[model samples]
Target: MTRRAAIEGKPVGSDAYVALEARYGHFTAMQVRDRRTRGLDLHLERLESANLELFGVALDRAAVLGSIRAVLGDDVRDASVRVYVVESGGRPLVMATAAPPFHLSGRPQSVKPVVYQRYLPHIKQAAGFPQAHLIRQVARDGFDEALLTTEDGVISEGAITNLGGFAGGRLIWPDAPMLRGITMGLLQRMDVPQERRPLKVAALPELDQVFLCNSRGVVPVSRVGDVELRQDGELMARVIGFYDAIAGDPLD
Candidate 1:
């Protein structure tokens, strides 16, 4: 399907696109299924919080939702939606767009650990140069994605997803600094025993199972560097069940 996108309530080129090119911005990706999305409130909260921190302005929740609804119209149901709050001309401009859906690959994902960390690990910003560079380098070395870590060899998160794993019959997330993904938050709310502690890259082989969670979904990790991990079907089923049970909020 041809992807559809808009900026500031008009086509991409209708306005001075200089601001859109700016790296000083924050965005949130949502899986819009049937014009609804899970954790819609959380997404709005993220945008609001980032806007205040990055641009010293409050984001309008109603206006942002309105823009998303208007851009999606009444027909497009399932889409990959991204809302960008960029600083341009000393003002904050909100741009909402929808593209084709990107579902999770149920197959195991291979990742290589990289010694890197984000600048503002808390807020989800548009600073993609560092991570992108790392990802490109790792891809060329025969890895599906890059797992970011600290210089001390502590696993933090993936280039684009949050890292979690099953250890000793519990879900364990890294204790290091990283963006708290909405999907991870939802999974934690499911009453699962979760732990946030420093995880060493050398200890990955000892974990029962590992996965990557993001807006797309929970994806199993088969290999981290050269060490292979267990690909448990039971764990994948439970994760999928937890996410599938989440009720989506309507855009309208």
Candidate 2:
């Protein structure tokens, strides 16, 4: 059993490669600014829940936080961080990795709808090959990301994000199963008029605007499989503003 947080080199999880190479674990990603991040509790809860579900053991909150703090160390305050909780020999180990930070790009994205869903859709698996593959495949279609949907064209989510739409001056979240992204959770807590319902692909044109949100950031959707959607600049701005208004929790 690996008790302490695995440490390797500066702010990067050199030891993490082995765990990921096995492709058998779950993880959470977050953008850290000045060693702080929004929804730290949500992230931790995700890890704890996945750990219990996958490894049948309670997650060590201290160990997980220790690894993340260790990887960030004193050198990395602003970066992209991923904490991986993997089991080996019936014991779970905590690993943390850091990379360059990225924020929301107001640039609208065009996505292609793909009729696919992830296995164990609830847990955020550490390694996602289908998402990577679909992303590459859709890039050939001149699309930014692959929108995962049901065969019936029921909108589910992005290959790597949560889907949101604005229609009739209200925020609508897909009622389908998804990872319940940290950003989405934070935004849901805000004072936005929103609803969760089963959204369909054909409904895209009827909506005023659509968007994709993840731990990195949220961006307006310009097109959904050739269906051009209007961009409600005011709505998107307000959503982003509400997200940013939430103070980040200090990592220390």
Candidate 3:
């Protein structure tokens, strides 16, 4: 496979492959390939908006799959997106949307991108079914994703996206299982201190709004854990407007 040395300031190809070693601590053949595939240039200018008050842009699956095809020279199909978007000081932030590991070492692998596995170790004391298994069950129950918080009471991210819950005049996050997303990262930088601790499912009623984020789905918080999330129409409109404005407009 053709490998790039680097992209903008981000790691790619072989460097990306190697970094997952340090991030995940051990090299499974499946993880190595997924890491490489996950590496792409995050061009915010191409996806940001006017006033620089950032909105989000959709991730083009075809484009990503095409790149993977170019690199691996193999049949690439069935890629799913995991969104992660953030806005900081009014600028849209884009970050990782990792695909599950694919075994290129000839094992006829079946991939299950389990969001629970990423944060399970951090919440071992929580009384619940295995997070990964629960996620699969949720999928079976007709939900698209799952959010796993730590024992400290902070909402983090989902099976495929980051969590944004509004309550008590602030946004909260548990700070485990996922990357501090580009959008969420920017929010934190702009004085939106994401509460990084353990969160509980029982706290849902207190949350006035809930939404998932990623660079692609730059949408607003609409629901949580089966409860109908409060809709901030103004917030949703602003986000949509921002997305529409930046998506096709010329950036300075």
Q: Rate the local accuracy (lDDT) of all candidates.
A: 0.83, 0.83, 0.39
Q: Which portions of model 3 miss their true places by more than 4 Å?
A: 1-136, 150-154, 186-198, 239-252
| lDDT by residue for model 2 (22-67), tens | 4678999898898999999999999889988998888888877887
lDDT of 3 by residue, 1-252 (tens): 333322222334544433322221110011123223121323322222211322334543343333333333333232322222333345332222234333322111111223333533321111223555666877776665566555544445664456666665566765455544444443444333356655565565567655555444445544454555466665545444543343221111
- After superposition of all CA atoms, the RMSD between model 1 and the true structure is 2.0
| Predicted structure 2: lDDT | 0.83
TM-score of each: 0.93, 0.93, 0.43
True-structure Cα RMSD, model 2: 3.6
Residue-level lDDT of model 1, residues 110-202, one tens digit each, is 999998889898788865777788889999999988999877789989998998889888999999889888898888887778889999888
The residue pairs that clash in candidate 1, if any, are none
User: Candidate 3 lDDT (Cα, whole model)?
Assistant: 0.39
**In model 2, what is the error at residue 104, expressed in angstroms?**
3.0
Q: Which parts of model 2 are misplaced by more than 4 Å?
A: 1-21
Task: Give the lDDT ranking, best first.
Answer: 2, 1, 3
